[model samples]
Target: MKTQSRWIGFIAIGMLVLMTVAPAFGAGRPETTATEQVTLRYSWWGGESRHNAFLDVLDMFMEEHPHIRVEAEYGGFSGYRDRLSAQMAANNQPDVFMSGHLPPWDILPWDARKDLSQFDLDLSYYDDTLMATFYAPDGFLIGVPQAGGVGGSYLINATLLDELGLELPSMFWTWDDFAELAQSVYDASGGTVYGALDEAGGVPYANAGPPHFDISYHNTTITNENGLALTADQLRFTYEWWGRLRESGAVSPADITAQADDGANSPIVNRDVAMLPIAMGSFSRFQDNTPDTLVLFPAPAGPNEPFTFGPGMSYQISAHTAHPQEAALLIAFLTNRRETGIRMGTEVGVPASGMYRDLLIEQGLSEAEEAMFELQNWIIANRDVRGDITVHARYNEFRDLVRAEQQAMAFGRQTIDQTVDAVVRHARNLGMNVR
Candidate 1:
């Protein structure tokens, strides 16, 4: 009888122990219900319209899932990278953050974002080539393209072009053709209104060239798998191309072009320039600035093929998030939901999902928005998803150095050969594998 009683006592103790340990380990516990509170932090950089649109989407998300609360962190693009880096260093990065799809940005590193393949997010409606751009070095998708990753376009002031009596160029127009049209606009406007912005002067020169983003000096790509693949002669061609525009008054001089920083001061918004080379997603801002009808068309092609592309943005989740499931759900709502895309419009970019894009199209879009969507579609159908060039952290610095030299060449302060030499030397000094 005593042995039986002792065995029963032992079993009771074991059960008590398990009950005590179960709460601590959270093992075999019932899952939290939808009524449980889940708060997530999301950050992005954009203007007021983007901010409002995001808030509206977040509001809708909260309404549908009442238990999840989202904290908003947003601001202008300036210092955004620095802020994100600081937050990450402190291990307090936002659960969801805006990440650039292009290389050498804050979130491009494999380690910077979580491998989202483990999540249950739906990406079936996205284009394969467009989807591939967001993959990490290990082929794990780290983010979903925002809008459709806005590509470069010729943001034409149709009103200005009409007033000038110049027809808009075809989507597949060549660089030589673009130059002729620009010259015609210049001559017809009697030099008061310029043909286009000197995209080489202040704007990034990569976008200034024809749409082929991968073109190198003597090769098909500017940067190869090993390193910088451009030659001095190829670099010279870029400078001389822009210099000719300055010579013909097709574009403004460096000093004059430097003042066009967008908003009310932008040459496009002010109607001082007939066309501007810019990303397709930014059309709304230019349109909002003026009542003039604006249209977006594919960038002029290079000598070989189309190179301009939608280097899209994405909503990347942090690996350190305490609410991974909630964060993933939020990302799905923002990136995959057709309603969210419709609400955001081109504020983010064209919708990344094919279904979302189709839905947005059916809902009807402004002329500018329609043009952006068409351009994105064309890019997906036509442009090659070139492999990324591993640029150093000082990539932008090198670009600035080259820009200064290009401006010097444009102003006749430096020769084209001198400009090329300076750029190559500067790039090499930055530890870039320039050819």
Candidate 2:
């Protein structure tokens, strides 16, 4: 009887020890309904409409998770950098933040910005192409594409195309094909209208402004620090192709060059043009602005293949966040197309997630959305990326200079070769390579 009592006492002591240790270790027990509430703060820069959409998603996440709480903050583009810098300095950056490639200004590297990498955020979901940029030279997956979104898809006025009996284009189209179709649309609409709108806004806007987020002069090469993985001759051909389009009137200076920064806010909404080149994910905003049904097609490829692409935005967890795991969870949730039905092309861009592209098709997007989804899927799977010029600190300044040279070429002040030479000289003079 005494022995039994001692064993019971020993067991009680063990249980007590475990109970004591459990609280210290956060416990091996399942989280209770009464566990501490986790609140994560997320901030991004976008228009009010974008804020609304993201909030809706956040709400949906909260509903699904039940225990987690989210605080969202968003604002316009102006002063975003200054505000974020302040946040970083204070070690109070949002749990998750919107990241893009407009660098020198951007504090990426996640370590510097306090980003998280060990979320085991399944890389298999994102297409290999989409994952490349998020990883730096050492292969730290600091961020992930919010939607693996594709940009540069031509958003055509479906009603205009219907009126003209021209079908909205297929997912894959080469530049030559684009020119032919634009010419046809031009002939049908006459000199009074044209087939497509350009992202090129007017001068000083045209001469010295930044290109759309996806428009890039070059991308970082993990292979080499100074030189890019792509050829300068290829980049030259890309510029030459743009020049040809500009010169041939397949794409005119008027539509593309109308809004320096407000590229979407211009004539396209007023129905002044038939097609506007924009990011696939941003189509929702453009669609909301106009009465026309907008369909997406891949960016016009070159004579050989479509170029590579980079992210318009990336979802990065702040290193400073108290809830790194929770923050990464939210990012993973947004990026995982299978969960939200967003990557399926309607909510975000086409699938950059290899595991998730089919899920997008499964979500039953509209015909217009479907085609765009397929195009981006192809790009992601195939690695046809235009990449970015984010590596060079002066890429932006150089790009603005290049834009001026291109505008001069378009305005007939400088010939294509002359402009190219000037651009090469300028880039080389800036301690860069210009083949």
Candidate 3:
């Protein structure tokens, strides 16, 4: 009777073990506890600061929404478009990506891959101008701008300025005032520094940098309804004026048309240049690179009264994104949220949404950035932000040609009229229908 009872117990135990282990071995592994993870891939081009800031923001985004995972890719500013084109050719584009609208290789065809109308997106959180950059002519907000990259005052070595016993205006300075400042600095430096280290080529056709100030100064852009900037004459005036700076010895001798050797090692970094119009985000970089305290302000005096500081660079979405709606939501959250927006730093443009901008001012920004914020607000309120307009298919080529002319003009090698005509001619030759 004892042995029979023991045998019965053993059989019961074995049966329970089989029931627990059998399902895992049979019929596709018992559904293996499904994982609720959604992965997205995002890419952009920027610096170490930008990359790190972006990673942090994305990490924050992920933490809030544990169901989502993001894979990020970035590189230095140079050769950014090449990577995008190569990746797209491999059909291995990230689920979502960031880009500017120009760079023919990216713009002309990249625009086709997206299908925003079909995507479930929300744009109510973003501002209208910020929405316009990516939208199709009919209407499709391609991406949300990370911020507006506006420029104002140069990082003047106040020690350098005040040491010279010169005083700036109480209110924001105009272009004429800026020229005087540059002149004063140059004179005071006794030729140790040039007033403004002309960044004629900095505003890349491939990328939007502060170099746009030249065109913006003249009330023209690379593209307009009238024609290419050079052809438009109004824009050409600035390039010609740039030539005069060289003639008057207010600028540098380096060829503006060539590659800009900008970094901690450049003349601007050495304080050999009196003025440099770097983005507000990287104002710290200028400080880090220079030997003095740096100050920030608005792009000096608009040629036509006060000027609306236009959107600098934006973080846009791919129209072909399989998860367009989700991507848009991510951007909206990043831009509209006060905390997330401030965490973004100056890596992207200044937050377009006023809500985010307030947070930034409340957080990391230095006195320079705050001062700039105030100046920009004043400009936005007083000047027309929409005063400038952009319209062109071959924007990259157009800007490049203008930059090339700036080089020539700054070097005093070309007449203003000749520079303008040359740029216009090249655009026409490239089959650009610049009106």
Candidate 4:
């Protein structure tokens, strides 16, 4: 009886001890159960390499966070914007989606995105100036920059230049020098290769292109508080310069330029042109498509130092997401994690986080990647002369209009002055408030 009583007492004491320690052990484990597990849908647009890198990162994220699942919806850049627009309209966008080159200001008016500042993301590693570009007018942190670097740069076919016995241009080469070097490329190549792609009709917002050059020339942004800061004469000068280049064959002809899609069809990749303007972040992808060695160079200097700050891409969470916390966690993992940075290399451009950038440098980089990294660092150091343009909601429409007009001018369907007039007239029609 005494033994039985003692056994009962020991069992009771053990149960009491377990009850005391069980809560502590439980605390160490995730509080979520099967019922509370989160599934986050993440979408991004990229090529095969970017898609693979992000998938690998997502796998790592899931492993570290068993309670969270990330469903990746990724594809090439084509039709991505339209598809995203469709999904957004249906109120079925992913929990997280990529905002290409610029913030999703068009969708923001629809209240389609969450203010990421409310999340528990650790953005301390990002530069304040860079972060400032991603905020909404109401001061919401609408999107986070995924990559950091000079968004405007020229990618040169170094192998072709060497073969043609031409020297690379100086780092601070002027617009005239660019014209001369481009002419030299054509002359030296004996007319087989053009000096540069005709970027006149390309995406104007690219800092390497005309709009930003106009900004540098006028010492102001293309748009201001009132409206279009650029004048018809300013725009005419840019088109006329390209017109001379096209006439001189220093740039690819209209048909050849039209073939450039920045993919396998790109003139630089096909070795049809010796130089092309590109977002510095895309150097690796372009490098991968060709056997020839490529190098990044600063966009030719203008009247004033050009504005060079742009996040190559940004990641924004959907306000409609059922799991904001999980989406935030995925974003934090992708952008701020050292492992992810190493894996991504310069795939998305240089890392936006200083810590990740430093870690990538420490991990060693390819020659091409090292060049991109060095260029990004240089831009960051010289980013004191910064400016901002008021991006209109119909900005894409305006961009398309400019590109079409450029093509029309290139094909001799319209004069530069007429192109400028049409641009101004249509810009106003599109509610751009063109001055």
Best candidate, lDDT: 4
TM-score of each: 0.84, 0.68, 0.73, 0.84
The 10-residue segment with the lowest total lDDT in model 4: 101-110
Q: Which ten residues in a row have the lowest lDDT in candidate 2?
A: 206-215
Question: What is the Cα-based lDDT of residue 33 in candidate 4?
Answer: 40
| lDDT tens digits, residue span 1-435, model 1 | 999999999999999999988746632334345568977889999998889999999999999888999999999977887898888886778889997746434434566777889899888998777777677667777788776754546778888888889898887776777788888889989988888887666454243222242352233433333445567777667667867898888987676675676665678888677877776666777788898888887666775655543365788898777777888889999877767878887777677778877777787877766777777777667666443534455655666676676667766788778877887888788777876
Residue 312 lDDT, candidate 2, scale 0-100: 51
- Pick the winner on lDDT between candidates 2 and 4: 4
What's the count of clashing pairs in each model shown? 9, 21, 14, 0
* lDDT, candidate 3, 1-435, per-residue tens: 999999999999999999999846532212112144666678877788779888888898888877677888888867877677676775656656666543222443536346444545455655565455455565654455566544344555665677667675445666667667777777787866677766553333323223345444655445544445443465455654544554554665554224344566555666666566655545655666666666666666555554443554555565445555556556656666666766775555556666677677666676656655665565556555541345465666666666666666555577667766777687787677665
Report residue 356 deviation for candidate 4 (angstroms). 2.1
**Lowest summed lDDT over 10 consecutive residues: which window, candidate 3?**
26-35
Error of 2 at 355 (Å): 9.2
lDDT of 2 by residue, 106-162 (tens): 534347543345666766666666667666656566577766665446667788778
Better of 3 and 4 by TM-score: 4
What's the TM for model 2?
Answer: 0.68
